[model samples]
Target: MDRMMMSDLLKTIFSVLLVLVVIIVSRNFIKILKMAVDGLISTEAILSILGLKIVLASAAFIVPAVFVSVLMVLGRMYRDQEMSALSSAGAGVGRLYIAVFKTIIPVVFAAAWMALYVSPWAASKVERIIFEEKQNIGVRAIAEGKFSEYNKGNLIFYVEKITTDNVMHDVFVQDKRENKVGIVTAEKAEVRTINNDLYIVFINGERVQGNAGEVDFVLETFAEYAMRLDSSTEIQENPITGIDTTKLLQTQDLKELSELHHRLSVPFSIIVLAIMAVPLAQVSPRSGVYGNLAAAFLIYFSFANFEKVSGSWMVNGEIPVWLGFWGVYFLAVLFIVILLVRLYGLAWVILQLKGKLV
Candidate 1:
């Protein structure tokens, strides 16, 4: 009988999680698609990339939601007197706890995989794809007859004609440096790459470089002049996703410590949350099955926020890293124990006020 109940509860939780994941993923994907369109990303490319991101994000978001939903479902069942019927037939609260424990072990293992392995791998791959696309696509976007500004007005380039080979005819280049304004005109120019640097090779051109309140200089260029184009700087700093869990464990850096704390906490949180949920799901005869859902949501969200706040404080050095990281979990565990004692009618004795107070 206990095994059957546990199976039913697991099925309910799985169904709820699936529905929630679909909803969240679809909503976020739509938002990302809009942003990609606004940024002029190709539709097919954006969809492909956004799909992967949505799956990763959905996995992270759904874990806690699954726990909450399961609690709500069980709470509703109790409120509707199904649990009461089982209790009358000799099923005890112990059975519920056992069921929850069975479910949580696998859930926590999956959560550990997501936080430690899957999420970072997905994030790193997505970041690399985005970087490559920006570099390659941006270079191809320079069109002829359009006044193109490169590097935030440091240089303005215009061409009257562009060919299939990216050669430009009647090219004009304007360089703005300090109070000086320099302009160069070339009869023909070609985009060239040398030593990983992008340059515009000009043929038959005259150069003028000067500024107001300064002596002006003018020179005629002969066969060729190479003007260097500034390219986007590739990021070299190690992103958080690039750091593995094992590597993080060996470091004492506050930021890395905080991230490691979060990774470890995610799985532990699943267990804590499961323990808290069982007692919270208890319902009186008069109340409906869904009566405690709002409260459960409130509690879950508060716990999540507390963890976030503690992690942030740890990273910022506003609190001792070890204390801030573990302190929140300890507090949560204490709260759960108190709630469980209350549910078991042992709170009065535990408070040591049974004889002293009414």
Candidate 2:
């Protein structure tokens, strides 16, 4: 019976994980494609970045998939009266838990590795690839007869034509800096690197600078002028997701601590949710295998959202970092106990425990 249960659980977990991965990957693919279209990322880097994104997405969904899979497999057994047969053959709830946990143990270990190491590695790779692509974007990404935006839309460049040698003609540049707007028009322009700094060298250009709608505008015409576009010294700070697990252990920053705790919570949640699923999966034979899924989903989403809100609270200093992440798991354990008692009755549960003790 345990072997059969383990087999069903494994199959269900893989099926659910695959379906979830496909759904998430499709949505993220659209966003990645848009990033390529907007020139935020290179077309050549799309597939590489997308593959890393899949790793991250799969890691994020694995715990939830396992939880849901547990519910479905156990619920099906109950609906099919297999659970009744087991109970008749001296298989108690404790026996069922042993079988469920035998499957969960390996999953928890695999999930721990993914959440701690693999996902962070993939996130860092994606960030590094994007930063490297953006460094050369000013020169390589520009196209004739199209407006391109850079520096997060603060700078716009438009060129009427481009020669085979990569010189631009009839170039228009608009830079919005705080309250001031600067406009430059050039007869011809070409990219030049001076001292490792990227600059657009414009010849026979006119410049106008002033606050918008203000009359005190400065206007000048130049024989040659250069505008800095990017510099080799520019550095992109690593986001929380990209930080290595070992490095996160050395930090005392609330945001970093929150992130660290979140990674740790992934594996912890797999265990807790699996335990909760044992009781939560209980349903009447007539209700069908999926009958309790609505309630299970509600609990699952609430559990996930609670973790998110707690992490935010920790990051914002609203809650102590030590308590914010693990408190929800404690509440989940309490909920599981309450659920077990509700299903089996307090006296029966106590009697079962006492019997085991004796």
Candidate 3:
């Protein structure tokens, strides 16, 4: 009975996990593609980012997927009267838990590894890839006969024609700075990297700098001039998700604390939710196969929202940092006790507890 039950649960978990991942990745794919088209990220990096995204998405949704899978698998058993058959054969709720946990124990460890380690690594890689791509914006943004804007619209670059050897003819650049604007036109130009900084090197160009329509405008002509585009010294502020778990452990930042708590919650949630699913999956055999799914979904979403709200509460100091999301987990466990009591009766629960204690 244990082997058979575990086999069904594993199959359901895989199917549910696959569906969740596809739905999530499809939604994110559009956003990633838009970033690539806007030149915020390079086209070549898209596939790499997408692969990493799948990993991140999988790790995240595995929690919900496992919960839903357990509910579905056991709910079906109830609906088909298999649970009744087992009960009549001297099996009980404790036996069911044993079978279910045979599958869940391994899953909890895997989810812990992914949440604590792999997810952060993937996030860091994605952030670094995007950062590196942005540094090459000077070369990536070039297109003949089109105007491109960069640096939050502080600079505009136009190339009338581009050649095979990466030379531009009739290039124009408009740079906007505080209280002044500079316009430059060149006969020939090319993007070049020097000293780890990107520059637009122009040959035989003239630059005009001053306020608009001002008589004090300054004009300078040069045989060759260079304008710095991007500096390597600019630091990229990585989000908390990208930080290594080991580094997160060394800090007491509320935001970072909340992130650490969030990562830990995944494995903890799997165990708690799996425990809840056993009793929650109980339904009248006549109630239909999907009867409990609606309620289970509502409970899952409520738990998810509570996680977010509690994380915010911790960050805002409304909740003790020590409590963190564990308070929410505690409430979930309490709800599970309530469910088990309702299903098996309070007297039976107490009797079982007493027996276990003995």
Candidate 4:
């Protein structure tokens, strides 16, 4: 009978926590995307990007949200004397641990799956979509009479007209180089792809090149002149999500290993946090139902920051990977256990004091 009541209470707590997480995460996602749109991304494209980003961000935040939620609920219960009632009815503060674990164990497993598998898959898909969309944006903008700038404003191109045959007419190109300005006027132009390079082929054009106050040199082009506009930038491969779990295991790089540990820790941290929340939630009767929420948030973040620092240290070889990854979590568990014991011991001492005084 007690088990059933505890289960019902936990369900109510979980539901409230889930709702709070969704609202907070959604608001954050919208704010971030609005900033991106204002910064030059097309509204339509930003909407698509926002959708992809919010899902991944929300998934990542689940464990932390759960930790905060549990703390809040338990703190309220304690402040309201519900926990005192339970204790008087032969339930110890430690019993709350069992009830919390029942809900948190499965949540931790789910978080682990998301961090290990689902997050990476989502990241890859988002990248592919963004890449493809960005590649076509300039071409689409040109058709609508928009001036397109690329290569950090070194190149400016405009197309007055485009046909169904993929042919462009009345093209103007400007190239800016050190002490040199080149302007090319073409009667017609067409985009062509060769060896993975995009070239604008100009037909019957004239080029003028010189400094602002120097004699300019002019050249006339007849049949075809191709201008290469694409420059390759160095791309650093990310280990976090672009690679699969199997690949992560194969790579022996410290950074990759650190990331691997970080991913695996997310789910495990949920269980530790749930255990920790049970005792941390205790509050004085006069403190009100929300009394311990601020403290709980601080403690949760402190533990999270410790884990992050440990991961960084592991990557730098300042600590052993396995030990560094688990050390913070172990410390957190120890701290929680001590706190739980103290809370129970304090309660028992207070009862004896009251009995003697009475």
Over 1-358, each residue of candidate 4 has an lDDT whose tens digit, in order, gives 2465356545755676567657766786677576455443445566675666656775677776777767776776777788878889988754776777776777777788888888777777666655544554554445536578866787788888888777888888898877578888888988777786667789988887877777666566667888875633534344366567678888888887877887788888887887787777777889865777787788878988898899888888899978778999889977975786587676774675588799
| Backbone clashes in model 2, listed as residue pairs | none
For model 2, the stretches where C-alpha displacement exceeds 4 angstroms are 142-234, 352-358
Candidate 3 lDDT tens digits, 216-280: 99899989999887544558878789889999899989999899999999999999999999999
RMSD for each model, in Å, please? 7.4, 7.7, 5.4, 7.9
State the weakest 10-residue window (summed lDDT) of model 3: 230-239
Tell me the deviation in Å of residue 350 in model 4. Answer: 20
Question: Which residue segments of model 3 deviate by more than 4 Å?
Answer: 144-229, 232-234
TM-score on alpha carbons, each prediction: 0.70, 0.75, 0.79, 0.68
Over 186-217, each residue of candidate 2 has an lDDT whose tens digit, in order, gives: 99999888886778899999999998678999
Better model by TM-score: candidate 1 vs candidate 2: 2
lDDT of candidate 2? 0.89
Enumerate residue pairs that collide in model 3.
none
**lDDT for model 4:** 0.73
Name the top lDDT candidate: 3
- Runs of candidate 1 exceeding 4 Å displacement: 140-231, 236-238, 347-358
